[model samples]
Target: MAIKEGLRPGGRSARVQDAIHSAVRALLQEQERSTVTVPQIAARAGVTPSTIYRRWGDLAALLADVALARMRPDSEPAETGSLRSDIRAWAEQYLDEMSSEPGRNMMRDVQASATPGYCVAIIGAQLQTILDRHPHEAAPSVDRLINLVVAPVVFRILFSAAALEVDELHRLIDIALRLD
Candidate 1:
């Protein structure tokens, strides 16, 4: 589905795009990001390599679009009245998704893309859309709560050597909310 103001293609173009995206997603599941190639994607999609090149210009663009599509549907933020509950629910949802197999695979691909700028552009749009939906609170405490839900976990994902446990995450959320 398209976003509120995003453009959506139609007709054969749409079909081809759908096919290519499905194929790329399937390929990511089967292989690592370093091993995916246009020829492989074409074979998986049951289309010629030329078709992919013509439609997407390159594999990175195609993969980025697929990732954006995968990430878009779950972008809705939780709306519990308390900032702690809301941010915990929202961050946990994001963390759960990112820790899943598909999410990890897509992240690997995004990290490896030669044209990461394009991938960033699409993913950033999705993040912005989520932020827009939530509409940040003015209270400093609420801002910290939101930041706790988002920033620290993201930092862990990028820098920590150990795997994250949900309990630890919940604790982080608790600390963020100042729930004692």
Candidate 2:
């Protein structure tokens, strides 16, 4: 049977991908980063190592794609009328994600890929796409505002530490989104 995205019908691809994701997610949670191995993932997924290699090309690519897919920004930012509201919405979406299992896995993978240009490229592309859709002009101030809005969440994720409370997150959103 044919599979679409993450959906599976009856056949191989869906089963394989699901197993792969499960294995990867579990490995990420249970093992140290340096200890994760292709054989371990394959065993956890109940597939052969060759199966993973065939499906995802390599571990880094597989991790990157999964991480980016999970981290894909939500629609919350779009309908929010005010800039502050929009930014808050964006930050909140991420906050919600950060509290989840998949979110934690994605965050860890992303941080690990810090030295990889492809990882930075992926983030830059996503950020640019989001900013491109905004009606307001892209000025230095606007750029700074976006950075300010983004910084708190990223800082928390990267540092493995919390930077802002709910109130502070809201305040940061308020300050960053102000058009003046």
For each candidate, the alpha-carbon lDDT, in order, equals: 0.63, 0.62
In candidate 2, what are the lDDT values of residues 1-180, reduced to their tens digit?
112456456577767777787788788788775688889999988889987777666677567556765555553244455444555565677666674656666766666544355434544554454555565843225456546755666666567555457777787766765557
Off by over 4 Å in 1: 1-8, 31-34, 114-148, 165-180
Count: clashes, candidate 1? 0
| Model 2: residues with Cα > 4 Å off, grouped in runs | 1-19, 26-36, 44-46, 51-61, 73-81, 99-102, 114-142
TM-score to true structure, per model: 0.64, 0.59
Best by TM-score: 1
113: Cα error in model 1, Å: 3.7
Q: What is the alpha-carbon lDDT of model 2 when measured against the actual structure?
A: 0.62
Model 1 lDDT per residue over 22-88, tens place: 8887877788877899999898878999888776677776776677677655535656665545555
The collision pairs in model 1 are none
